[model samples]
Target: MTVPALYRGLFDDAALFPPGDLPLPEAVPAHAVHRTAWYAEAVGPFLVGAGRLAELTAVLAGAPLRVALVLPDGAGQLAPALADAGALSVAGVELADPDVRAAVTALDGQLPAGVQAAVELPRGDGLPAALDVLAGTPYRAKFRTGGLAAGAFPTETELAGFLAGCAERALPYKCTAGLHHAVRHTDPATGFEHHGFLNVLLAAVAGPDEKLAAEALAERSGALLAAAAHDLTDDQVRQARERFTAFGTCSIVEPLEDLAALGLLTAPAPQEDR
Candidate 1:
């Protein structure tokens, strides 16, 4: 099945990250399989932290793996990580630092040609300043939508503010953590409220209106959200995706299941068949 342009490269494979922490040895082969699946267009590059480059390269045995290198320790690790990424196709780079200015300064002219970079901004008071710093550069923005702790998830109002800020600057952005599903719903086991990836797409479609974006984010009706998404014009879809970009998800299968259930994607075959 041909994935829609809006959903193509939407789900970055983060199987190596927490919650799904599949060992690198296993994760590499699993990622290779995902890249060849029917829904391959929906999958983006594999995400690996800078610290794990050695371990990742060791397991590859010369097999090529595309990756979004994450530098959680801050900009100081960017240089050595890139230097160490032998044979790994570094498609993108992500840096999470409280000092957004410093991070931007450190990342200036550091990446190879064509490798995109995203600065994970700190939420709340300093967010605007961070976005302002990134606005002057080519690097995109990254937001943390959910995490292991309940506190890691941003409220609709907070996220709406972020969407608005980025839209105002015409800055592109991506999201990570807690967006395991495609629609807004409460996790039954942990009771952690997770933001739906579709809701976020709709919110981005809402543009710079924080109130409308927040309303979109808060919408839980699957049919309503799916209908809105389906009704989007080709240009609207382009504009929304241009600003929102993609998100990191641990389980590619779960998202495929959600999209299929919403009628956004054809139901994929069983795990064994895939």
Candidate 2:
């Protein structure tokens, strides 16, 4: 099935990450299924930590897999991680480092051609400078939208600032963690607030205005947000996606289910037996 351009390649599989923590053995096959599934176009590369490349290779046994290598330990681990990724296709690299400039410098001349890199900037006073450093470069930016703790989830204002910053620089970016559903809501079990992926998309399409973006992020009405998404024109979707890019989610099915619930995605009719 042809996925909508707005949602195509929007979800990066992070089954191995926290919460879901699907074992590498299970994740490998599950990812393979997702790749061939009808919703395949909506999925992006399988995410794995840099340290897990060897383990991932051992399990794959030469089966081709595209991966987004996560460098948690920062720039020092990038070279060795890429070296270990020889057995698999490295689709992209994500570097989480406090020193954004240094990480960008270290990343220069290191990644293989066609493999995009995103530096996870510290969401602090230095964010603008970090964005400035990444502007006009081939690299993209990454933001941590949510995590295990309450503090890990950036407030609507903060996230709006981030979207505005990226828009101003025209720097493309992807999000990680905390965006579990299609609409913004507090998790009933954990009581932790989570940013809805749909809200983020609408906010990005709102352009560089921090206030408008913040309002979109703060909106909790599913019908309203879904309506806004449906109202988006082809050019609007293209421009928004060009800046917002994709986001990482632990469960690919969760987002798919959410989108289906929002009436954004319709399941294909089952085939009749011959």
Candidate 3:
């Protein structure tokens, strides 16, 4: 089955930081391989940190590269950084800082045309104010799905609230971290629970209703999630993607392999025309 339109361009390569932290040279080639992989369509741009922008340019040696840049905390000038990275296209920028609002506001007039931005908001009392500010801007929202520790993962309630707020405001968002697999499950070593990308996709498609979305985020049944994914009509898939966008993952192969195992992508499923 072929990967659906809802999931195409879902996994952004984030091998440069955190858990995977592959070397820049190694990651550049790996990203090249992924762009040619059988599941290539399901992949997105390489996520590179602002600090590594110069390094990435050096490694690619004049080959054109597309990247989603993660800005450093307290960053003030985005244009100067991009100016130094040769042949690098900044597709998106992930901004998370104590002064997120100011930084985003500062970037208002300086951003390259068509370059997207995702602002990561705190998940508590400050959320609404942040959402309110972002709702009026062209920026999209960003959420952290999981981290190295269990505390990094937000509860179902928190996740649901975030989804509902975005839905209510008609804000599109992207997720990063802890979505290594296609289904929700407990990590044997860390014992930290993880959210499934498929589950999140379904929840986004299910609309912003808190109760229903929370259930989808907490769901563990791969078969049920697979069925939901299989049942998506073309337009429904597009609608879901418009809101959910794509997520960042350390390994693109993991999600693709898991989806393939679930038979949701074993062969091309019949398409339904409107």
Candidate 4:
């Protein structure tokens, strides 16, 4: 299965591998991020400006990259910061406000050849509608992403609704933030506890029966792929929770080594992907 690495690209460092390495196996770096007025004041618009966009594109052009460029899906205008960025294949819409429709409509075909129009389901039926429109065109299906703005992780039922919606629509989705750990582990790097949001893999395991799938995901307190997350008793769950919690990405000692061995993330995937 192809696992797309969810990148919260705030850090200056790489997420999946060492910074200097270009390719690794079975992982695609997702390089989309957001900016705020406060951020501009703190870091300056130069990083979020058009020049930055061009530079970003150049860096990822051959890196098996799926970059999520945040278009100001509000004013219905591509920020001058993005105007000269030149050819983005994946667009991650920031729907903190409810102006997504206007934003995408304004882009129309200007949204690069084969570019995806990702709409966060902030409000209304816009995302489904937008996905439907993008699918009929030559463009690949737009991504159904974004849920972190709500301040709390999704409840089991809410997540179940999302999974059911994805299955019904046949859309493949990905996420960021709150999902930093490989499993339901604490950030060994930071002492704070992270909510285990591993329902992603359980949806894969349990298939499409929503209730069965949801119950399947909710039962685990760790990454779903690990042996510990498999079918278990309440007593086992209670006792194993601490053990299931991972210490850090350091625990990823081997698989990452294997991906590096395969040279997966370096050069871009061949033409079929492009």
Every model's TM-score: 0.96, 0.98, 0.93, 0.47
lDDT of 3 by residue, 89-161 (tens): 7787887766667867756867778988888877778887888888868888988989988899988778878
Worst 10 residues of 4 by lDDT: 37-46
Q: For candidate 2, what's the RMSD?
A: 0.9
What does candidate 2 score on TM?
0.98
Model 4 bad stretches (over 4 Å):
1-66, 72-82, 87-97, 123-150, 185-198, 204-208, 221-224, 227-274
Best by TM-score: 2
Cα error of candidate 3 at position 181, Å? 0.9
lDDT of model 1, residue 264: 88
- In model 1, where is the ten-residue run with the lowest total lDDT? 265-274
Give the lowest summed-lDDT range of ten residues in model 2. 1-10
Better of 2 and 4 by lDDT: 2
Question: What is the C-alpha lDDT profile of model 4 across 165-214, one tens digit per residue?
Answer: 55555544433334443333444655433333344444433434678656
lDDT of 2 by residue, 1-274 (tens): 4577889999999999998999999999999999999999999999999778889999999999999999988788889989989968899999977787778887896888899999998888899999999898899899999999999999999999999999998999999999989999999999998999999999999789999999999999999998999999999999889988899988999999998899889879899999
Candidate 3 residue-wise lDDT at 55: 79
**Which candidate do you rate higher for TM-score, 1 or 3?**
1
Please report, in order, the local distance difference test score of every candidate based on alpha carbons.
Answer: 0.91, 0.92, 0.83, 0.37
